[model samples]
Target: MSVSTPSSRPSASSSASPSVADLVAATPADRNRVVDLLRGAAILVVCLGHWLMAGVHVDGAGELRRTGLLGIATWTHPLTWVLQVMPVFFLVGGYANAISWRGARARGTTYGGWLRARLRRLTIPLLPLMLFWAAVAPLASALGVDGGTLRIASMASLVPTWFLAVYLLVVALTPLTLALWERCGWWSVLGGAAVAGLVDLVSVGGDLLAVGFCNYLFVWGTVHQLGYAWRDGALPGAAHRLGLAAVGLVGLLLLVGVGPYGVSMVGVGGHGVDNSYPARVTLLFLGLLQAGVVTALEPALARFAARPRVWAATVLVNARIMTVYLWHLTALGIVVGLSLALGGVGLHLQPGTGTWWATRPLWFAVLAATTALLVTLLGRLEQPAPDPRPAPPAVLPVAALLATCAGLAVMADLGIADADGTVNAWLPWVPLVAAVALGTVRLPAVRRRGDRSAPGGYLAP
Candidate 1:
């Protein structure tokens, strides 16, 4: 196959189907249409995966119960390996950030300016969602919901947030990482991978489990570095993409077969030891596989994405991504709650039963409809505003980024709110919205010529 050099200039071809070249031409010069498509695709896949993986049931007591679908069918662990797309997300994120960061520096955009812009895109639409939960949590508690259930309910709504927290950190560190990449070169990536490998080794060794959490920085940081490699043209052409994919597949086989990691990338039942949660050594390989597949397919996918209908669909999906991701489980919970209250479906089927297997489609359908309603009501905030607005002080943006990370980290440790909706238990919820408001402040708006208000187009989505 011919080497794929993404052209800076749009194609001059007048073909019937809009080519990737035409799509780039239609975009602002700095925008990479391929990266946008990849981000868009990853968002859709993740939302769908969540919907499919949710395991909801009504118990004999008519109370709603929720569990992971993978936990329900342990034998299906291998499927998680295919569906796991977090690696793809970080890979695209790294590539987009590297590109955006370089462009920002060229245009003299400051760390605060670039970061504020990106975080604003992320959190602006999240305000109403946070406020809704805040108000509802107290109300739900007043209605006599149990503390444990309420905690689970609150946490369920925001599980997607842990990812954002980590990603925001990645965004904050991009300037520094790229600078390191320049001097130390690929060694920066090797250093990260070595650390991640060590963390995995130690975690499995039955001691120093707490140290493994560091992979949230190093493992993902390394994957992000791979993105840098892509952005800088260090890994171009069909051969490189294919080779990476081949190696990743081989490495994955060895890791699962010869190493201690499970077959499931998301891990099974009691242990989350795979490519998913804290991330493991296999994720580096998974990143390679995902990035390779995406890169190799870019030439074809770009053309397909360039078609007007396809482009519109992708745009619509991306516009509501944060909303969809944040509210999906809430919708599922609503459905489960209603099902329990209604009782016709309560305790009707057991896990691993033939009847339960037939209902998965129906369960998914209800979730899809409920999520759609929520998105319809809340999606506008997520839409990219056509106008570029003024931004607050550099300190505010920095605070916002760090603040949200803190909130998300706490949420990771605790739920968004506790039973009775105690203010202190949920204090961490404050930053998710506060950060956006700070970053979104209209402070003497400024911009260069040929400016576009495309959010991720500027800082990568």
Candidate 2:
């Protein structure tokens, strides 16, 4: 495929106008809608997978697998083909990064400054939730709660955070990655795919690179380059789109059916290592297929997304996408914790027999209800600051992102320090607490740009 170089001149719409959000807002509807639809799809899939995998309990008396909501963990492996949407997540991410980077360059914002601003939204709210859980786990243990249960809950809460780390790496390298895209064109993406495949082959027993997580570079990096493709219309026209989809689907099918890779996409622990664990080449194929399918249908999707109600809802959610993504896991945890505290939550899983199929409807209702409560209480994070006015360039929200990531990293690294006998386990949580405190105080500076009446005034939601 041929790649069109990024134009140095401002895009047609930008040539006559000057505004940050406006420029971002004015990005072609086709690209914007693609990001929204992909995000919506990714979140939905994640929720589905979580519903199947959270709060699974085993029977104490019977060797048979008793049931919990997470009981499906035993057999949900096959659903990965239908349920895993990681590829799309990265694809949309690439698009967002490309747009943001382009806009930042146009506005003369430094790369570091532009990134810190975007990263703040992604990292801020995570601070409070992480601290709340860190405190809760220790408190519950002290109060005689089952240690195993508390550990499980903590592990589940940290599941989605892997993406945060990988995404940060991608964001931090935006300048270099974009430069590669510009220099090598489509070949850069192909090279990424090749690198991922090579890593998977050499890793063999999952010893190297932590179950192919290293491919976060190659697989995700490849999909991200396609965002550049989307921007340039390099994959334009119906015929080209269809051809790309066909090739991607055919390649993906071969991988699952006869290639060395396994068919499952969610994850299989103790299998030595898993491709899905870190997102490998198989997911790269999915990204290509998803992007092609979305691009081919962009015109139609744009028309549909333009309806007043539909567009309004998208705008509202887009405003809060970070909140929803970060908090959905918290939502499930609340339900699980509540259920456990209330004495018992009925979950009967026959395991391999798949007898729980009928109960799925009820389980889904419980999860939905739990999510609603979580959203209502924590959704405040989704709201724009009362003042829609964007902070000045220098004041953009880097502190929040840097503060939160550092905190989480420190928290995660505590065991290392303790193993070396150099630091206390509890010391790590201190950074986490400090990060959240700083973020809460700094978030107001991250609002959108608009006219302001008073120095610290906010616009009403």
Candidate 3:
């Protein structure tokens, strides 16, 4: 790994809760600034991307209908290419997981324990967001909101939550995946790619929708494996990174230009095939293309992030990542609701019109400000919970994580409510995930103490 370990940085709530400035100051000098830079930029791009693209209008009876710029303006494909950042997040996550897991194992942590600690952080932040949605459904339904819009808005708001489900599955399988990487090296990635191609072929040729879903593993799993390569210096040199970027660019162009792939990185729902969903080869190309872009930009971004002011901003953004993501859709909803109530001129126009273009800057500014406020108000919930005074039982962490994943997967399909839009489906996940996250102790830390004599820190080369 290029990154050298530094002294432990304090938590956001070490003494009193950290201010954004304090959080920035607390970052260790030896940590990977470039990774954090990429993270910060990616999060903002995602937030603003949705806000800028979202076109909401009232139905005749008055409920917000969501639309996107890609459907409206065919010229927006290049922009989607620039902003689709999920691949970068997964790659960085792979790298980060490699480092952290090695660190934990060095101190002799068990796979189960390490898995528990990892999944807890991911799941805890979700409860509040889901709970808020759960609470709102009945009230909104009672107020006579259009059933279709209510359903669409609720599901749309939680769209980002699918990443958590996917990520948790990845993290849960990390020990196994890492082991596969150890034994097979880059062959694992190649295998995944092959599987992905086969999936596309089978799904497309056979007219089987279920088979396409397997791309989640074949595509992202391959990219995640690349993170292992990245951490171990297997992906060495600017030439390597640039070559990847170049090839990925060509591959993406071929997929979109020649293949049946949709041009947009994000899929507009209710369309026959949302490119982002159901895992297409196009997204795999996106991963390749974006990974190359990330590598190409890393050096410059690292240098820029080293600036004290820039670093501080990055820290602030990083601190509330899940919080920001969770709240961003709500921010859009609020802004759209307000704009409609006020009868804002720009928002009322067709999305691609010249007047809409002129009004975007102001609209963006308004959305950003509103999102910041929402983050400020709820972001703290995402901060790591105070070190548990008395840790919970060591057993069942993985099981809990699985239940959580299942719940989230279900939620992704059904939204906060069932297909009928009843919040009753909130079972097994909301309560189950909450109980595990809150009730569980610090699994890794607790495990590390008992087995300090082992010599198993970093994974074998």
Cα error of candidate 3 at position 425, Å: 6.4
Off by over 4 Å in 3: 1-14, 59-63, 269-273, 338-347, 386-395, 417-461
Task: At residue 173, give the lDDT of candidate 1.
Answer: 91
TM-score of each predicted structure versus truth: 0.83, 0.76, 0.86
Candidate 1 C-alpha lDDT tens digits along 1-461: 11123443233244422333343344544444577677777776776677666555556775556666777777778776667887777887787777667877877877777787777677666666666666776777788866666776667666787888888888789999888888887789778877888888887687566777788888788888878877777777999888888978898889888887777787454744555656788888887788788888877987887687776666566556788877887786687666656764633666556787787677778888998999888775563443355445678888887777787777655775544545343554577456546655333255333332223222233
Candidate 2 structure, TM-score to reference: 0.76
**Better by TM-score, candidate 2 or 1:** 1
Best by TM-score: 3
lDDT of 2 by residue, 294-406 (tens): 78888887788767666555644554455566667656667667766665455435433456666767777887777666655655544323333344343333454444555
- Candidate 2 CA-lDDT value: 0.59
C-alpha RMSD values across all candidates: 5.9, 7.6, 5.4
- As a whole number from 0 to 100, the lDDT of residue 33 in candidate 3 is 77
> Each candidate's lDDT (Cα)?
0.69, 0.59, 0.68
